[model samples]
Target: MQQLAFYQSLWATERRRPGVPERPVSERFDAVKADGYHGMAIDLGAMTLEQARATVPEFARTGLGGLLTAFPQSVDDLRPAIRLAKDIGSPFLIVIGQVMPLSVAGMIPVIREWLALARAEGMPLQFETHRDCITNDLFATVQLLDAIPEMRMAADLSHYVVNREMLYPIRPEYRALISRVLARCDSFQGRVASRNQVQVPIGFPQHAKWVATFLDWWTEGLAGWRGRAGPDDTAIFMCELGPPEYALTDARGDELSDRRQEALQIRAMVEDRWKALGA
Candidate 1:
C-alpha cells in the first residue's frame, strides 16, 4: 500500500502557546504515531535551515519521516533543507513556492532554478498547490503546467476550491478543471473546504456537502493516479488537517476535538477510495 503521512505545523503552533513551552519534536512525533499515522510532512517554512536541521533529529527519533515542505525564496536557499530531508530519510523535497512574479513567463525561471537545484543535489522535488505562493492562483498554475511539462505537484485542493469559489455539487465544468489538476498531481492532501471557506471541520452537518465534494474529487484523483502510475510507483497521501486555527478550537485554547482523529478519518476515507478504485 502507498504510505500516508500527517503534516506538522509545529513551529507555527508552538509559538501560539503563550505560557507553555513548545512541544518537543519527539512529542509531536509521538502524538502522530499514537494516532496511527505512518509518517509526517515537516513544515519548514517557518524555520531557518539551521533550525530545521536541529529539529529533524527529533522527528527521526519518533520513527516518522516524509517530505519537507518549504517556501524558499531562492533556489539556493533550499540546499540545507534538502540536506535535512536526506538526513531524516525523507524521499521528497516539497516546495510550496512563495515568491510570485509579475507574469507567467516570469515564473518559469524560478521553477527551472529549483528543478536544476534538485537535479544537481539528487533530491526529488514536487511543487505544492497552495495559496500566497507562485502556484497561488489556479488559472496561473494551469498556464505554468503548459509551459513546463515536467512540473510535478502535490495537490492540496483546499486552495483551489477557495481560489475558484466552487459551489457545492460541483459543476461539470469545474470538475473538468479539477480533473486536469488531478492528472498532474503525484500526491494528495487532507482538508475539506467549500468554495467560500478554506477549511471546515469534518462531520459538521453544514460541511457535509463540501466533504462529499472533496471525497468525490479524491476518488477521481486516486483512480487517475493508479491508472497512470506503474506498479513500482508509490503515490503519497498526506493527512494535513491543520490545528487550532486551521482546526476548530474551543475556549481555553484546547482543540474542539482531536485533530489527529480527524486526520485519521481523512486517511481512512482516502484509503477506502483507493481500494474502491482498485476494485
Candidate 2:
C-alpha cells in the first residue's frame, strides 16, 4: 500500500517577535509529535548547520521522522547536507539552491552537478520550487524540466502563484504551466497563497478561492503521484506555514491567524484527499 506522511516545519513553530517568547526545540518537537505529525523538517535556511546537527538526537527521543531542507549556495555545500540527511534517516534531502543564474540554460549544469553529487553520496535529492532559488521562476522551471528529463521536484505552489502574480480564474497558459509542474512533483509543501502573498490565512473568507485552487492542484498532484510511485512508497506533504514574514502580521507584529490550527487543518485537508483516492 502507498503511504502519505505529514511533516511539521520547525521553522513554522517559531514565534520570534517583540513580545512573544520563542518555544524551545524540545517543546516544539513534543508538540509536533503530540499533534500526530509523523515527521519534522529542519530548515537550514532558518538555522545554522550545527544547530541542525544538534537536533538529530531529539528526533530519536520523540520518535518523529526527520527531514532536512538546505539552501546551498554551491554544489559543494550540498554534500554535508546530504550526509546530515542520512544521519537523520531522512528519505530524501530537499534542496532550495541559492545559486541563481541569468538564464535557464545556465541552470541546467548546476542542477545536474547537484544531482550527481547526491547520487554519488547515495542520497535522493528534490529541488524545491521556491523564490530566491534556482527554481524560482515558473517559466524557467518549466524549461528546466524539459531540459532535464529525470529531475523531480518538491512542489511549493505558493511561490509560483505569487512569483507569477496569478489571479483567480487561472488562464489556460498558466494552468498548462502548473500542470507541467505538478506532474513532476515528488513531494509537496502546504501553504495557501494568493498571487500577491506567499502565505495567506487559509480560513479567511477573502482567500477562499485561492484555497480551493490549491486543493484542486494538490489532489491532481496526488493522483499523479499514485500513478507514478512505487506500491509501498510514501508521499510526504509538509505543512510549512512560516512565522513572521510569511505569516501576515497585524499592527503590533502579531499574526492575524493561528498558524498551529491552520497547519493541522492543512494536514487534514491533504489526508482527506489521499484517502478519497481509495487506492
- Highest lDDT: give the candidate number: 2
Q: Over the stretch 1-279, how does candidate 1's per-residue lDDT look in tens digits?
A: 443344444442342445867776667667766766666676776566777677666665777656678888876778877888898777788898777897999999899899888989998788888988999988888888889888888888999998888876777877887788888887888788778767787878888888888888877877888777777667777777665466666677775556556667888888787777766
- lDDT tens per residue, model 2, 1-279: 999999999999999797768988999999999999999999999999999999999899999999999999998999889988988889999999998999998999999999999989998889899999999999999999999998999999999999999978889999999999999999999999998999999999999999899999999999999999999999999999999888999998889999999999988988999999964
For every model in order, what is the number of clashing pairs?
A: 0, 0
TM-score of model 2 vs. true structure? 0.98
* Candidate 2: pairs in clash: none
lDDT of all predictions: 0.76, 0.93
Poorly placed runs, candidate 1 (over 4 Å): 1-21, 250-254
Model 2 lDDT at residue 10: 94
Error of 2 at 181 (Å): 0.9
Model 2 residue 93 CA deviation in Å: 0.8
